[model samples]
Target: MEPVSEPSPDLAALADSVREIEHHVGEAGWDGPVRVFALVRTQEMLRTEPGLAARLDPSVLVSAREQPWHLTSVEQEELPVAPDLETLLAGLSWPSTVDGMAVSVERVVLPPAAEEAMPQDTDAALEYLLAHPERQDVRLVVGALRDGPSWCAVRSRANDTAEQVGQGPDLVPGLVAAVRSTLD
Candidate 1:
């Protein structure tokens, strides 16, 4: 994962917006990894989803029209514990090429066998799960666009990639979408 940079004024404002969205989605209480995707200028998205061009900000569309990578920077980092989510997000900045952002969150669900052995204490449960990997069941990856396009994928613990399970507006809505919207 790339090291996150200090957030510029614009980035800070964007983070604040995302925090509100996350609060609405209850992600503030979720224990999981958050992946940030920087949407830069690229033709791939236009090729795959031509209609997206119409919804994008005109300035972004024009700037990215000739760029090689539409999605330039993708960084996956753990949520910081201190300074709060808004503060943390506000401190990070994206390259000038970036026009939008999205966040992907993942949560691992334990299987019955693992749940049966779960400890009553939260910390103990985490330790128990770490000690016994077999108890893990599905890992859910949720992708939410700032503009409201949401998608989710699920995979067994043994699998390397997740399979798309569902996608659409408000399917797995949250702070990720709010962050993405800031780019717009």
Candidate 2:
């Protein structure tokens, strides 16, 4: 394996933003709908819409102005109906105003051994996954910029504590790619 290296400022910001998003989503507990967010430069957003300051917490505004690398995530309210997240993300396109995008999705993961007994039908497969002995419920929060780095954070239901969240650039590659696609 390659030696670990220090992360760049932009990448560090991405990681912070991704983990922040994960924490925000975790507050609502589990079994929630898929959520998507638009990541924008905190300073840019406040500059473009000064009135927004009235509704934001003072600490948030302070952080935005103090930390140039701080990112703001705006939850999307109206999402187009799609069968699955991959397809939904595949068709999404973000405006230039948005620096990046993030998504929170819950999935059931099973070990390699469980794959052999998976059912063929979609419904059956989902049931099998949910009922598996070694199943894990995970919430993946991934973000990517238009022409910059990407970040991912994974939190398992069994260990939903803030300190238990795992993070990496490529932890969830497929979701990271989808987020990047929206930026393009």
Candidate 3:
């Protein structure tokens, strides 16, 4: 088992930023395409792209003024194609202009008991899982910073309530690590 990550001064900011991205994706409903967004410091972004300020949320601008670090999300307009989401993420390397990134993707999750009964064939496995009574459709919004901090938020479609959403650093380690690598 992996150890829980130590919280940094920036942890709360990153977590809130991640949650914001997650909420943005949820606004579009489910079964949407995997979305990726670059998280950049609001101050730096404004400094580099001043014209974008008018398009940004006024509240984000207000918050940026009060905090030393405020991050804003910028959705990727065109993503490079890959056979799978993990492979696509593993291949990414972000520029310094980007302080971090967040990804929203839906996945099928099954209980531990269902693992042994899972079908071996790719097609059959998917069918079996989809047909499984315990199957859950979940959306995971994961984010990682260049400074080695990460956050994750998960909402199962079965009960996607504000109180039901799960948040943690290690909730999705593999994915957090993959995104973290890009920042590194």
Alpha-carbon RMSD, each predicted model: 14.0, 2.1, 3.4
Greater-TM-score candidate between 1 and 2: 2
lDDT of 1 by residue, 4-112 (tens): 7764433443333333333333333344445555543346657676888777678657745643433323343554554444454555555444555655444556678
Every model's TM-score: 0.39, 0.92, 0.93
Q: Could you give candidate 3's per-residue lDDT for residues 9-127 as a string of tens digits? A: 46777898999998889999999999999988888888888999899779988988776568888899799999999888888889888888999999999999997899899999999
lDDT (0 to 1) per candidate: 0.48, 0.88, 0.88
Give the better candidate number (2 or 3) by TM-score.
3
In Å, residue 110's CA in model 3 sits off its true spot by 0.4
| Better lDDT candidate (1, 3) | 3
How does candidate 1 score on lDDT? 0.48
Clashing pairs for predicted structure model 1, backbone only: 6-91, 7-91, 7-92, 12-90, 22-175, 41-70, 42-70, 146-180, 146-181
Q: Which lDDT value does model 3 have at 87?
A: 87
Model 2 lDDT per residue over 36-122, tens place: 999888888889998988988898888888778778889998999999998999978988999999999998888888888899998
Error of 2 at 89 (Å): 0.7
